[model samples]
Target: MDASVRLHLLKSCISYATHDHVRKSGHRASMPPKALLLTSQPSLRNVVSRAWRAATSITPYQTSCFKPNKNWTLRSIDHGARPYSAKTKPTVSAVLKNIKDHTAENIVSIFHSRSNNPYHNLAIENYLLRNSHAQSKILLFYTNRPCVVIGRNQNPWLECNIAKIQEGLPWNAADWDDGVLDNDRHVIAEERDGYNVSLDLVRRRSGGGTVIHDVGNLNFSFIVPNDKDFTRDKHAELIVRALMAPMTVTRFRDHVLYDNVHVNQRHDIVMTCANVDGGNTQKEFKVSGSAFKLTRGRALHHGTILHSSPNINRQVFVAGDEGGQVAASVFSALLSSPAKPFLEAKGVGSVRSPVHNLFDVTDQVQRREVVRSLRKEIGQLFMDVNGMGDISVEEVGDEDCAVDMNGEIYRDAQELMTDDWRFCQTPTFEYRSEDAGGALKMRFQVKHGLIQNASLEHVELDAEQQLKFAGLEGKKLHEIQSWTSCLPPHAGFRHAKACAHLETVFPKIQPAGAAREGGAESTIIQEADLSGSNQDGIAVKRKAPGGRIELERGGENVVVER
Candidate 1:
């Protein structure tokens, strides 16, 4: 008669029906709707409707039970719910269980991460490497947002343009627009700002050259047992086969040549094509770069596939003999350009090669289609190579997925995001810079991203100035908020010029908010000085708000202004 009493009765009836159904069918019904009888009372009907909906909507794989609080309201108990958060997503344990179940000996498991966070994706890959069954083979595919990923043993400063990476790449709206007829460019413009989209710097637990990742690229990692038969080029060759597969598009069919694509001596996937000038000359372009990580019993071989990177040259073919100069992506060339001459780094350096996007060769192949083709092709190849059958494939990450922040995967991601891992992990290096006027020369010996030694020459310093110069030692290069702050206040014209040179050569790292706010005022210096001598033997010039300064070799003197 009363609401509470009726609620109890309704719950009992549902429970009894559920148990009876399990007894008869050997499986629990998701919700025994048939056991629910129509109730005329308004108060009881609302409770019954809520309980029934909640129970029925639960997935078959999920087990839920109805529980009543003191308020007489019903709540469905979720066994998979994580203690850290109440969101309805798969728990870390559940996901790990799923992975463990599929990863048996002789099994090939394919996991595609939906998260664009490089740290998260890489952490998931690492988990599979360490946690999955040792004998099982794993293929993980993921794409990250714009980020420059350096190898574990590589120097970030030597491998990438840290300033550019910190400032972020420009957002090109047209490049990202899906060609849906109903899409509005204005709405897209409103949604995104066409300014500096800052890229995250990630240091992966792998040993190889640095690489740039953007939405236009796809990353694949293969985790196989560390057996004697394993080779670095094995998976790389599989990628080549996938790339050489016949394209459905007739227009680009001729472009996909088998001999044109193969793994080189460097274990990199490269594509060779005829010069667009109709000459007999051929051009080679690197489409993918490989990196490997080895554990005691497992080996991880991962690489990138440049499909339709917007940062690259839009023109499919260049006009003249200079056609070979086109890079795979602007970011790849600019960001990964050697920071030599200025920085004598100790870690691994990227081998400079002309890179080309696969889209250019295939006439803008769809990224999704490329991923699908690669997955299918690689799955079959893996099975055939391992002499296995019936591989398991599934997508692993999602927006709603519950991530255990305290777990090993989260810790791994956090470690990758730390400043120590990003900067301090860099090998020993020396940075030498001289003012355009030749009045000031500075050399810094950096180890573990800290200035172990600082030398300032060609400039006279007073007691305070000398102290400031000495202070530069033991300071972290990345932690310096402003380069000018490191110089003595009103020390001299020479100091001012040296400050400008240092600022121009090595832009101080700024927070994302500060970078966005002050980016407009930031000076853009040509990278020619950092890379070394200019081929044309021309003067390198830098423009500031006050005046322009030109750097030239020979007897030419630098022109400076107040």
Candidate 2:
């Protein structure tokens, strides 16, 4: 017979057996054998199956719903009742007094919530919150269906796709049931009627090492080993690790259900970040109570979990490379250490510095001042990286380079050549020049830092002239120019090369021996020469006959015989 026919026959036989028992117990059975039994013909089988189901209210054992025990008499109830005082109650006061009594005999019977399954991590957390005095908790979770949970230190969206869930193909879903069906016992109880159920602690972690096993039909429970249980830290770490773990996509073929009832997608890998900074920092911890954002947006509220270290800032971010978050946290903790009274004298508040220390400080106050200054500087330092066209590197003499107020070298000044250069609020490079009198002058600017900015002390095969005539070749230079042009005419930084070139080419035309001279580093373009003469040596002179005369050498009409 086919599977469906066999199923119908087995259901009929079970119904017959139930009715037989009712008849023997002197109760009139509603179901008849002819109606309960299936026939060889498909149509007859269906008609009989329907008639039997309609006649008898006997639900199969498999689909039995839980109902409260209402038929028990007072005598039967009394037999099950036990005195609360006589029964061993793990009291809050008793657990506290026995925490330090680790002689293996003091808190011998005091096991917290006797459960051992690692999947109970979430339940353990809830247990801890409810009984404030409960020493600790163990979580136990069991399922024929497989699943993968995220880490405590990770951004979920970057780790997994939410749009997929909205698309109905939730990265995690099942075939037998909708992916969002409630798996909670209370929810299940409310949905299914008529059930009396009791939960008892089944699995446990005692004096032995971690054990993994299936203890048939028993409800998994948690156990707090002793007063000096390390589960608290371990559980916290596990939670952090889970939350911070990276998100991943996978198929359910691996951890398949045995009965195939709760068929689901099972991911083998735990998607959590391994790095210490994989989670959130102190600043991000209190934002929205979320470990990460769903999308990249300016969220008014967001949150993260940080590794709280007493030695460092307890609230450091855990989402950057280099583990800088943890390191900065450590430094912050030391700054606010009670043993260090000297830091307090400097008038710096105890708030931990969020970013790495970028400035040198002699004391706590100086450190905080440096941090404050750094914060203020960062606010002003807004660079629209997208607005930047192209990037090129140039080495101005080592002396030409100077750290900005924020201490970052704005080496690529040419990037600022775009018209919106004013958008680059960060001080990148500072320019310094000397006059013939030895007085030094300075101007602040940024560079896409092209080779043209470098100074040549002497001519080598006349490379300077070749380069000047060659003009800028890099695509980056052109891009910067293009971007700069898009801004207002005067918005961006002017290349110093323009002014320096004018200075160098100007002095060579001075009358012999009349050239302005001084510091070799300074060009001889004095004030008077700048206001006169074109490069063709056309000297503008006042004529003896009242009008100004433009004079040039080799002119045929020049007949003045002085």
* Candidate number achieving the greatest TM-score relative to the actual structure: 1
Candidate 1 wrongly placed segments (more than 4 Å): 1-93, 97-101, 173-193, 247-259, 275-280, 314-329, 336-339, 361-365, 398-406, 434-436, 458-468, 489-493, 510-562
Residue-pair clashes per candidate: 2, 54
Tell me the whole-model lDDT of each prediction, alpha carbons only.
Answer: 0.59, 0.23
Candidate 2 achieves a global lDDT of 0.23
Tens-place lDDT per residue, model 1, 1-562, is 2344345446754554444444546433222222222233656655654564454443322322333323212222333422221222432335554556658732676666656667778878888888888888888887776677889988776787766566565544333322100111011111123355566678899988878777667899999898996899999998887776564224345433323688999999988777643656687888899999999799999999876566666332111224354423455444643345577778787777777766544222244455555566666677677777654556555221223322667677667777888788888888876534663666777788787656566446653354356567558877877777786644334766766766655666553212221143536577443344243243445433322233343322222211
Worst 10 residues of 2 by lDDT: 70-79
* Superposed Cα deviation of residue 344, candidate 2 (Å): 36
Which model scores highest in lDDT? 1
Give per-model TM-scores.
0.66, 0.19
